[model samples]
Target: MAQTDVDSRNAQFWDELCGSGLARSLGITENTPESLQKFDHAYMGMYPYLQPYVTDEDLAGRKVMEIGLGYGTLGQLIASRGCLYHGLDIAPGPVAMMRYRLEFLGQDLGDRIRQGSALEIPWPDASFDCVYSIGCLHHTGNLPRAVAEVHRVLVPGGKAIVMLYHRHSLRQVIQIPVRYVRDRLSGRRRFASFGEAARAYYDTNAQGEAAPHTDVVSRAQVRQSLFRQFSRVRIDSQNFDTYVLLRGRIVIPRERFLNNLARVLGTDLNIVATK
Candidate 1:
């Protein structure tokens, strides 16, 4: 599909179901202060590594731009840490949510939030000291172009922290193939191959609809192509379900074993790069 068509499809998908549509299930039914707090707690519960990786102390006084405003969780944290927090998203739903979140906190940073695409970041060259995106760039359809745009906007020696899906993840390696076989046998959908099933599974939301695009990459692919412009890059794999092999029907018995396994097989490829 063309980039413009992909962008339009993503915009429509996110605009219709803001933040993966997980808010309601996580006890966030309204846009109140209480609901926002609930979402932050739930979000951290799901991705505890975020707090340490995206530290407020390091970003206390920097010009930081977040490429995606998922329920405004990280954007609010960035502003509260005393950083100049600028945010952009492909959909108005998240942009508005982030603005409302800032307003509710009395931060008055609504003007800094805009609705746009990651393919062409609407910022000047060397405009920011830090660019942060989590679980966003991989869905942009053109990961290399998005990364180049990120590099273009960051000043020399600036930092960028992004999270992309890992192609070598446990989800991709084992669970997806099993899922493909099961679905194909059950006649749920006609899948030509495992590759087609993997793409559909990864891009699907809770509503069972797939997004326009999603990309997964190995560390080597990222280092060689997506982030080649950066002077330094570090990629770490994290985030995995204990019962992934069993589809979470039963929890895995060993915590230490799972932690060790997640280091290499975790689905999220957290990239910390310096441009």
Candidate 2:
């Protein structure tokens, strides 16, 4: 799709996301501390990387920016830690809802979230002490430009923690055969082999995300293409895939094998860097 077309689709997708009530789904209601703690437990369980990388020290009295405010959950987390939180999303719908939700829950975010693009962050250079974006940059019109902006907005010794889709993953492996069959049936000569077909499909398809345009890349591509402005970079894999089997209503366990498999390969690429 053309960049303009993707931009339009992304705007619509995030606009819908704002009304999705993702926070309520996590059991965080209008109640105070108790509800928030429940939500934090659920969030950390799902995305454990944030627990270690985004520590209390990183947030205390610092300027922290989250490039994508998914359900306003992270906005709450960032603000509760006493950091000046600046949230940004390409669509204004999420940005608006994020501000309202955070305030409605009795959180005091000094300034409201910003409605803007990661490709051209609407903040000045060296604007933040720490910047983090999770599962967001890959859907952008220009991934490298979005990443570069993260670097541009960080202080000299600031850090950024980012997550993107992994190119080499069980998800891609599963898609190869599926795409190979679909391609033969649809009469599209898009790949030379099933492996190539799978990569092409995974690279282009949105995979049920909130955006239409998406891309997955290897660890090296992330290190080379996205982590340039950082003085140090560390890339790792997370959300390791485990094989599963079901028969009738009873589920079969492959725990031993799946555990080992996950130890090596995960579907998400995590990058931690400092400028």
Candidate 3:
């Protein structure tokens, strides 16, 4: 596709994803918010691996910006640590939901949450002490540009931590076959909307109905991108083992194996860059 066409399509995809009433359909109301909360906790739990290299003290009293603040879990965590938390997401639903949830938690950090794109942040240069994106930058068509924007917004000594899908991971290896079978079975003519995709994941263990996974970056590409703009850079891997047997009836005890495999396969690449 042409560059302009690709940009237009990605923009439309995110707009629909944010606009869709999928959150409501997925029963993500305030009454039953634990599901989303749990997901955030899981991601935050991985911070320890990166924490040894960076400390919470380093983040204290600093302006921190997180791109794609899904469910506001990380933002809430950041706020709890006394850091100035600014979160932006392409989806308005998540933005509103996060604001409401945070208010209920009595952490109503006003004007800290906004709806925006990572590629085009609405902030000035050197505006943040730390700029980070977790499992978000890969969705953009211009990954390098997004990294450049993150670097652009960082202060002279700022830090950034970015998470992207690792093509070499075991999860990708397992998911590809599942997606293929699902797409063949669905026989749908067009890509499912964001709401439909969420429902499919909730009802079925398949994600083939959702938007296609975009680009996958290797460790070398990740290193190149961060090193080009920042001074210090480090890359590490994380793994989460999720699988089912007998069509979701039987569960597999692969967490230990997957964790080991992550160490072996070196999937789930995280890069920390200093500006």
**How many residue pairs clash in each candidate at the backbone level?**
0, 0, 0
Give each model's whole-structure lDDT.
0.82, 0.70, 0.65
Candidate 3 residue spans exceeding 4 A from truth:
1-57, 105-110, 173-208, 243-251
Error of 2 at 145 (Å): 0.5
**Deviation of model 2 at 142, angstroms:** 0.6
Ranking by lDDT: 1, 2, 3
Task: Report the C-alpha lDDT of model 1 over 15-48, residue by residue, as the tens digit.
Answer: 7544556686875667788888888887777777
lDDT of 3 by residue, 52-140 (tens): 43344477788988887655566666666667778887667567766766675676567788887778888899999988777677766
Residue pairs of candidate 3 with colliding backbone atoms = none
Q: What's model 3's overall lDDT?
A: 0.65
Clashing pairs in 1: none
Residue pairs clashing, model 2:
none
TM-score of each: 0.91, 0.76, 0.72
Output the lDDT of residue 107, model 2: 62
